[model samples]
Target: MAPNKVDIRPGVSVLAVLRHLNYKPWFALAEFVDNAVQSYARHQEALRAHHGDEFKLVVNIDIDTAAPARISIRDNAAGIALEDFGRAFRPAAIPPDRSGLAEFGMGMKSAACWFAPQWSVRTSAFGEDVARTVRFEIENIVNDEIEELDIHEELEDVNHHYTEIILEDIFQVPVGRTVGKLKEHLTDIYRVFIREGTLELRFGGDALTPQEPPVLTAPYFREKDQPARLWRKDVSFDFGDGLSVHGFAALRETANTAKAGFSLFRRGRVIEGSGDEGYRPAAIFGSSNSFRYQRLFGELHLDGFEVSHTKDGFRWDENEQPFLELLREHLDSEELPLLKQAEGYRARPARAQLANTATQAVNNTARAMEDNLPSALPDIADAPPVDAPDEELPHAGTLARKEFNIRFRDKDWHISIELTEDPAESQWLVFSDVAASIERPRRLDIRVSMIHPFMVRFAQTDSEDVEALLRVAAALALAEVIARESGVRHAGTIRRNVNDIVRSALSEA
Candidate 1:
């Protein structure tokens, strides 16, 4: 009988698949770091034997922005052995055991392909005498030109053990800003490893540092009359199946949006929080008043929850629900009343910080104007009175622009002023209505055009006192006219007249 013949049809294009892998530049780069850290952990015994317990696991990321850009991640870890070359580069091969951070076995290849069209790895296993190399080209693979990975071997010292992944013709070169963002993301994601001193990660020669979450000790009540009492609780519970969760919840004396929310960690690495979801319980964050629990923040380590493939979030399976429900129960019974009391103690009508700052600034500017313009302005108080023409004094109606009796419907009007670099040729000042008005108060924002030739000339003076006075005068003058004529049909005419007066006064001063 003839040997059976089999044929398999290709399902997808390799490059196309990689192009849609959905890896952000930073997250893709993280995959390599993840592999290096895991390798270091797996070979801790060998590394210690060779370099002593003082040995530090280091991963360095270097990027070249020249034409045909390149990126390389080098790690001082137990490198790949010659025999494992096939598994390392294969698309879907799994490791012999599920240990360390190397799971699914696709991170390395997927990350490499996502970063560049061609890449190579140079690695030498611990105690090995030869270093192995494997190069991959997506173009070659997609075209079906390369049947197998071409491995190269080089003689090396037995003690040398390291792996360096070099990506050539990088799809995108990370500029300085992009690198900085990457450093921040990686620092947070791998904070646990960095904090424990198990791994030292560096980019452009600077080591990444971990950021610790702030701890809250008291309930945050903005009202000064009510003194705050710090409240905190330790939470620990089991979900059966050898799974458990443990952490602490605290209410602060001041509500901090930045520090609010639950930070969930898995295996010492933060997978969520600082704004990524999953730890919000209705009992804590579910009040009709969003800020009722904004003062609440905490961390919870899910002992048995599985993270998504991207490692950016949790799976949210049935196993995780028990812990969340238990947390909600505790918060509803123990913490809700304290939060409500803190809310009640808060001052009902609080003045905004910006308004207070603006008021203080205006006062200081008025004093400065008095000092600088004491002689600039004519002494009207001491001027001789001029005789009025005996032509019958015009009736009040003829002398006054119609008084509309405009009243602001809102109890408070928030006015903010800012300087912008608009061209001198443009309007000297502009006004815009600020959307998202603060509660109980309407806000109006004004921008003083700094690029106006008049402003530019004043700005070049020896001191900013003159410019500050001019800006404040213009803003106040304009605001006075707008507010006085708010309901008048001809308010635009009044605004123009006010602008002319302000411009003449500023120019003469």
Candidate 2:
């Protein structure tokens, strides 16, 4: 056959504008992969018959980063047939079948032009003896306002079926950290197909494999006495508007704020939450710092959802909130109650984890406080006397209390600290008796209310921050005891002054 011409005439303007499209590197690369996947899917029966049942579709994407950078995506699949040549090359020529991933024919042209100054496609259809090649010089075509692209042809084996897209002088190249991220996004997007063993997608000669997020398995937080159960729960909901979701909701085996939350899928490919940007809506995941937001995870396939042209997001059509509400209801229940379980469950840290946390906290708090303690003790010891009331301590809402000993000023000092969450507790800092006993060490126990207004406003929610604050409180409590021991009559005055500073100044924040 003579060299053929594919008239992309009407799309002259559209082709020039495509280069400016806001395409993330992964999504742009996905356009080519989508076409390859659709081709394999469409001709699966014929392809298997020709190449034997053991055959599986494999797509290799290679990036040449050395000077004069180039990108090539080669797929062993049912390549473009001679009859579909015009529709395949022409811009905006929608395929007769919109059910497949290649519904938008513009994906190839736009992605190719967006990637480089020049790109080419070479393919030989499964049952044909002729292989075709089409080179697109984007800069020359746009500058000259060319309407047609010449398709080159060559004789090939009748059974050969493959497509190779080579892009040269590429402007958009994945480099450094972006190369790793690109592989991750691509793996996540095609996870379903990869899991089914139908697709072998590779980048830089290495096959991309899906890494399944491990689900939590343990007794419910409130039902600690019960036998451990797998936390993964199957969820299915219908919106009654042709749209439906079917998937499994579960908590991660371990909390990972970066990897938590839902992955939304459409037609077996993830549209949202591919890679680290898992879909974390407040309606389902709660506040970002909530346990659910850090441990919860799932794969929800939206069967009838419409995706953006870029195939990056779903077009919910104002039903996103409603969709989220339905999703939340499914994930929450009196039986398992995924949301509640996720929020309430606290994994008992391993011995190493507990020790590591304690060690880190001690190192951080003591380092900073050691600098100020010497100067503070002198002032506390010289304080004037004020009558301090001795009131009965209330241990009603005590959540937890820990007792430890520290050697300070040649005396073994026993420290007892209590944490309380009760709203009724009026005292933000409750001081207990510091028994000066000849039988044992000088023991001073103090209580701190966590739900106090001052704590809620001034205190940070992190454990490290809370630990630092408590260390400061403990240091002050110890200082007052030492001042009283040193015969400072107004040692109680220091407590009153410190309370006023915390309440009047710090709480205002």
Candidate 3:
């Protein structure tokens, strides 16, 4: 028989496909954040945390609907060389000498195309006072069209030791409203850069600081002002049908009450944990991650896990399945149960400490009010015992911000409340801050960042109608009742101490 001939279809360009796909806004931001991270990592050889003493990333966002919207990200890192322009935007163009964060070259330009049709990058290298600029028009690239004149070139007139990316005519609207979130995302995603002191983030007048501090605290920290961590020896051994888990079951105490926890890592880089996602079941002390509760810090040396250079550094397999099932199973079967039991034991000390502190606080507050009250006011003895709710109280609001304190056993909890008027937004905020003398000895730090619409109403001035005062009073009273039931003292108690405060605050003349 004659040899059979086969025809093949051309594969789609990765850039072309990425350009059309609507990736999540954060994922797109991740690319720019990664660029900032890599730039600093490359320049700062010591692997210092980002946002340290001097180097930085600045993101400027302007949202004027009528005017053109623009999102610009600028970083103080090693800028691209003019000679490397051709290969910079090409796929899988990993520079031979590239290491640190920019191993894969597709990040810079591809990330822009995820949200905008046109974007521009401007850069300047060390010692060289001049900057170089490049413009990548995704619209042009998608159509497979190229023009000879529109190529990368050096801008000798420009001066700086920095790099910048400007995404013009944003195709994604969320980018405009999420500048705050973008700052947070970058702060967390590039925490290593920050701890190394090689990267900084500037928003408005404040240098963005992550809620969590540097991961390393010892030799590496003193050596290079870098955050270095001692690898954990904890591991899980799976044999036959069951799994055995071993790790530090105690929370490491830190003078800094800031949160820390076990973070997910891919290719030796962290993915999630802290306040973003995942849990550190061991870190019941001051951190937010549940995984850290078990101090489950160690290596999971699984081979052939697909870690793409352009990805957000999430763990994945070639088949696109999340590669954490086995890990999760191990944790659930072994680590979690033990962690829970350990937490119960740890809670005893926390509870006793809280009770002693709470009693003292109540006594102090009572003494302070002793001379300020009217004769008719009841004595501290007659005052109701600190009534705190055993269960968390739910709240919803908009346009108004409220806070209260609760007495829990031996602790004082500070609770903050905020409500939003938007109907489509989340409707409630509820969280607790334990008053631990060693950690949160002073005041409980509670926050409700998001507010619900149902609880939202327009702000009113003193001149409002009688009905308005009544409504406000009722709200305050309800809030007070909820606080009492929760054993939490309302931080805003003084403001709403008298009925007149509510009336005056809500009434509109």
- TM per model? 0.62, 0.78, 0.47
Error of 3 at 356 (Å): 23
The whole-model C-alpha lDDT of candidate 3 against the native structure comes to 0.44
How large is the C-alpha RMSD of every model relative to the true structure? 15.3, 8.2, 18.3
What lDDT score is found at residue 165 in candidate 2? 97
Q: What is the lDDT of residue 456 in candidate 2?
A: 50
Deviation of model 2 at 192, angstroms: 0.5
Tens digits of per-residue lDDT for model 2, 360-409 = 54445554444554556544323333233364457675555666665545
Off by over 4 Å in 3: 1-16, 45-66, 147-159, 175-177, 213-262, 266-269, 279-306, 313-338, 342-509
The best-first sequence of candidates by lDDT reads 2, 1, 3
Total clashing pairs for each candidate: 10, 3, 64
Score residue 339 of candidate 2 by CA lDDT: 91
User: What tens digits encode model 1's per-residue C-alpha lDDT throughout 1-509?
Assistant: 11111111132255437756777777788778888887888889879987998897899999989989999999988998766665666666677765556777677888888889989989999989988777877787777844465567789999899999999998878897777778776776777788888889898888988655444343333333555555666778887876788887766455544546677877776677633332556655765335544556666777877777666677876755566578766654543344444333332112243233334444454454334433443332132212211122111111001111111322333444444442332445455443223453334444444334444334322124334644564445444434433433444455455556556654322
List the global CA lDDT of all models.
0.60, 0.78, 0.44
Better of 1 and 3 by TM-score: 1
Better of 1 and 2 by TM-score: 2
User: Which candidate number would show the highest TM-score if scored against the true structure?
Assistant: 2
- The 10 consecutive residues of candidate 3 with the worst lDDT sum are 1-10
lDDT of 3 by residue, 103-126 (tens): 666676567777677788777875
